[model samples]
Target: MTIPHFISIGHITHDLVGNGITPGGPALYSTCAARNLGISVGMITSFSRPLLQPGLLQGIDIRCQESQKTTTFANLYNEHGERRQIIESVADRITSTLIPPEWRAVSIVNICPVANEYLPEIVRLFDKALIGICPQGWMRRWDSKGQVFRKKWENFKEVLPYADIVFFSEEDVSDPKKAVETYLPYTKMVIVTQGKLGASIYSHNGVHRSPAFPTIEVDPTGAGDVFATAFLIRYFETHDVPESARFANCVASFVVEKEGIYGIPGLDDVKRRLNVAR
Candidate 1:
């Protein structure tokens, strides 16, 4: 079997959108973006069987652990563009054992945990891969009523050290600067997505800002995940932070123009947008 060039580990979620439940999650979004960018993708996730049907992922390889219920989230967006979330249910956690031995050496690995379903120990399993982390789920804690709130990652020291890059939003924590500072010492790069304001990249040199391409955002649900996916892929190829950020911002611009995964662009689409932006 050909090894996937990109692998994402997390829970494929059932997002309550309007009157329907849409299949979503960071792992799903990232893998879709990776596939759209012409990379072979793989996902190790836990979800109920019917939640994900045939052909949903198309060419990507998927390894699923059966769960009683797919993790579920109800997202409520306020007038200020802030998202208030309630986790209705959680699926089974993803363990390192679920990852095939051959896949452990894939070129790129993203540890994308939503609802804290990934164990910190899983980060060590990707010894030969460039490990990127989307830490939103680790920074969240929900109330008794299931209302999700921000909380410091209790195991940042253990996980951050193993992560080559870490991605999160300015809204992921109350203090984005502090979060960047905390992760910078451990990881090679830290990126904070500031929604329409664009994103900031923090590395050894200093902080650099990248502007978001102006677009009418139909829904901002998976834009950040798309951005992270684009950045990691570009960085893997070019190894240039500023160039990667510009490319990622352009890729993510398309994600907001439509709903769900429909907006994730292929390379030709991204090139056209880049040329237009230029």
Candidate 2:
């Protein structure tokens, strides 16, 4: 079978996590996950080579928007593995031209965000490709008194239509009474991840639920992003929504079993656990 090329959108950051500081930026993890799953992956993200290794550093092709410095953040975590705070990051936004002209050959586009990089307009460019989105990075975030507080934007309502697949957590599913109706029109499928509770998929066709694979979770930082990335690349092999959710749940479980993004499971690990789960 021929490998299909994929372009992951966003930024690679020099993450400064404490007791937790591990390198993670969805652009980095998602692309790594896709490549590990045997998919051809390219990256469309701004990186300061001084701070970020070349995309090839991890099997991803580079179309890096050469900025002076890559975004860097210090994620502080208590013993519980919940991330809080943004010690620092360079402010940079991605425009359409950031995508390399040759990258049009790609079949999948994962719009993983960092800071404010994956804006709606940039997402629209992938209208023809399968787009897997992790909107947490896009959520309205501000550093207040040295800590990060995240919330939905009043105007965030408008960016919904551009994504083919949307990933969010239970906290993001806020006010389900209103969210279900408000978010439905713009999305083809919406995944509400509930940490250990598992994940729920909502679409025009209705809903599907998948329970989480049991694991002694070590880190929660990039679990959702890893879940979305694995689900998109592997599940697309079947396009079965429930299977996709289940595959993602497995990836999430494996993600939490270790510390940081480096914990993202390999294909064999994912396949082994998936088999054991079955």
Candidate 3:
């Protein structure tokens, strides 16, 4: 089996925006960001559609468990730009048994559960790789009408101890600082993204604030996923937390200026923007 440098496991979603249905989810966005940064990437997901669409992460390895329905979300934005989501459909859960043996040794692993499709035990599947957890999906609950709402991550203790780093948006929790405080005891590092306001990083060393790069915001769909992906990739390479946060913020700035995967930038483009931001 060909081992990729990065691996993201979750359910790839079909998101409803305006009158169009687009492929989305953290796993897909992370793979696109990883590929643009010139890293060999692999994704494990459960989807009903063709896993690799035309012009989407063409060369990356994507493993799929054929499912009856793809995880779907209808995004409704208010006049103030806040988003309200409805779960239109859902795919199958990604079980540990679906993971390939060789892929366990990948350098960086991102367990991105976009719709609560992952079990907490799946975090233990990796050995020494840096495991980044994006738990928005785990923190969500929907009603009979499928309206999404934030709920406590009931089994966070079961998973956080095994993760090297945890990333989430301020909107994902009631209080971002308290959420970071809650996660720091179990994980080595915790990052709470505040969109245009920037991000905060908490680690053993101390808390560092990384400012966002100014850009015209087009769509905020996968900005957090791209930020987490860039941070993990850069941190894995250099082990510099402050530098990684700044680089991540710069990379994510580009993604929000465009729609969906088209916003994911190459390393050179990111470097240029990083230099300008400095």
TM-scores for every candidate against the unseen true structure: 0.97, 0.87, 0.97
lDDT of 2: 0.72
lDDT of 3 by residue, 55-96 (tens): 786878988888999999998877666889999899998887
lDDT per residue, candidate 2, 117-189, as tens digits? 6556776565567777777676647665435567764444556676678777766545653665666787788
Question: How many clashes show up in model 3?
Answer: 0
Q: Alpha carbon lDDT of residue 163, candidate 2?
A: 65
- Candidate 1 — what's its lDDT? 0.89
lDDT of 1 at 217: 87
TM-score, cand. 3 vs. native: 0.97
**Model 1 residue pairs with clashes:** none
Query: Which is better, 1 or 2, measured by TM-score?
Result: 1
lDDT of 1 at 191: 93
Give per-residue lDDT, candidate 1, residue 84: 88
Model 2, residue 188: C-alpha shift (Å) = 1.2
- Separate clash counts for every candidate: 0, 2, 0
Clashing residue pairs in candidate 2 are 17-21, 18-21
